[model samples]
Target: MQFSSIVGQGEIKQRLINTVKENRVSHAQLFLGPEGSGSLALAIAYAQYVSCEDKSDHDSCGVCASCRKYQKLVHPDLHFSYPFFAKHKDDTALSFIEQWRDAIIKHPYLSLDIWRGYLDAENKQANINIAECHQIIKKLSFKPFESAYKILILWLPEYLDKTGNALLKIIEEPQPNTLFLLVAQNQDQILNTILSRTQLVKIPCLNDNEVKQYLINEHHQTEHAAAEIAFLSDGNLTEALAMLNNDESSYHDYFLKWLRMCFSNKGLEIVDFVDVLAKLGRENQKNFMRYGISYIRECCMLLAGAGNLVHLPAKELDTAQKMISVMSLPMAAAISELLEKAHYHVERNANPKILFLDVSLQIVKILKFKTIPQGTHYIPN
Candidate 1:
């Protein structure tokens, strides 16, 4: 992947290119960033620039032999190591190379949940097993087949367990011309020993404007739709992309209607509403819950006299202001917690009908009866 192909992160791309230009390329570097921030794509682009036979001043030439191979992720000198569900004792990332290539090529902003869909995951735990650790050592032992450097990009080193220690010697004193690039999200989950050895390249999340423009220019989103998704996504490109696939435009109306039903204590209507929610499917259900949570939080902000911090658009802001007149801060908090719990359950494949009914009842208790549920305390006005 070329740096131009990745969205945003202009400073990061230049910095990575500078490392190569100045001949200060670190053999082992960690590209640490939140998910959907294009950290993995940045790492791949950096590696391609390093391996490019006809490198330009700012980026790699897309037509060179090395560039062609790297674009397809079939370069002999370019290797990848990532967390996988190993079915056998000797299974390594190489076993799922084709799946890995397809998934990454399809969406470089891939999350673990998306990757799980690519494999026969079936509730299996994903990790870099001892076999993969040994495989890394063996792979790095070889010399570069074509490029100037042999690059191994290990995604999510946080999945590496204690067995990752087997590569300590190599990391500390790697063979000449061998580079280890580790792409990870959470720093706290990684091994301290490995963390200490690698050079840290921090990548920040994309800004709201960047995500908004990308949706408009690349995805052909309407200006208003792009703005709404960008605000709701909060710098998460993966979430924005997912929202594009689903019908999130009606969330505001649906959420407002649900609140109206709960507030009026309309039992029969709520049951029908629950039936409709149950049919949204898992992703839509989760997105709907998320929309409700965000909307409720905005109401809470208004109730707490923090209207300046709210990010809702004008129409939603008008609705939020009107809603806050009838809702108390504590009630909004309670309902927000309920929506959060519903979102969690939806992610775990809960029965949507039961989950929505339960959540609706909880909202009724808070809004109509002004009673907070057990285990969730809200400060009284």
Candidate 2:
């Protein structure tokens, strides 16, 4: 992924290019952002630019032998360490390097959960453990075989456990002409030692315009549809692209239905809906929960006469507006919290059926949490 080829984050790319020009490239840097924000793309592009023999001001020289290798992710000096599931306690990142390369080659915006799906993991947890740290040390011990600087790109360093800390010391002070680019979505979860050693780069999500353009050009999405999807995607390019395929919109529908059901206190209907959600795979279930949260937020804006602040389609906004008319604002707040908790539990591998059922019941009950009439004075009966 060349820097110029990436969609957004012009300032970040310029900063990286300036580093090379100033001859003050940090030995280690962390590209921290939520998924689909082009962090990995920037890392690879920066690596190529540093390695390119005849690089230009704006981008890497794509025709260089070094550039060609990095383009294919076969560059000798470009190493990657990431979370992967092993067959037993012995599984490691090196075991799946080939598959990892292939996956990223196809789509760099993917999540770790997407990668886990390729490894035959059926809802099992994966992480980059201590053993991989030994491998990383061995790889960095050698000098750059071809490039000016050897670059190590660690995707999702948050998955690193205690054993992984051993490699942090060397990452802090790699041999001359070496660079470490650690990409993580959550910085607070990483070890303090590792966090302190590297320069931190914050990559913000793409704006709605940026995402909408990408959809129209790449997915042949209609202009109107692309605009609305971009708004609802909330700066997540991964989710925007997914919505382009139409399958993800089902979650939005489900969310709408669930909200209406809760507002009406339809007990039997919500119970059946919970059963269906419980049967979905963990990833899909998590997605729906996220969708629910987003819709509730939009609905809250509707209740507060901030409809213009919402990103829903005209029809969606109209529908939500009607629901908001009958729905209590306090109840919406509570339901949003319930959905937030459900997403958190889903992330932690909670039983989705139980979680959804509990959440549904809470939503039903929240519908009954009454607000006192404004300025009504009451005496004890």
Query: Model 2 reaches what TM-score against the true structure?
Result: 0.92
Q: What digit string (tens of lDDT, one per residue) describes model 1 on residues 58-150?
A: 899999999999999999999999999988899999999999999999998988777877896734678999999889899999999999999
Candidate 1 local distance difference test against the native: 0.90
The per-residue C-alpha lDDT of model 2 at residue 328 equals: 66
Model 2 lDDT tens row, 97-121: 8888888887778676668777777
For model 1, the stretches where C-alpha displacement exceeds 4 angstroms are: 120-122, 261-282, 305-315, 337-361, 372-381
Note the Cα lDDT for every prediction shown.
0.90, 0.81
Clashes of each: 0, 1
Q: Best candidate per lDDT, number? A: 1
Query: What's the CA error at residue 181 for candidate 2, in Å?
Result: 0.8
Each prediction's RMSD to truth: 2.8, 3.7
Pairs in clash, predicted candidate 2: 130-163
Clashes of 2: 1
How many angstroms is residue 28 displaced in model 2 relative to the true structure, after the best TM-score fit? 0.9
For each candidate in turn, the TM-score is 0.88, 0.92
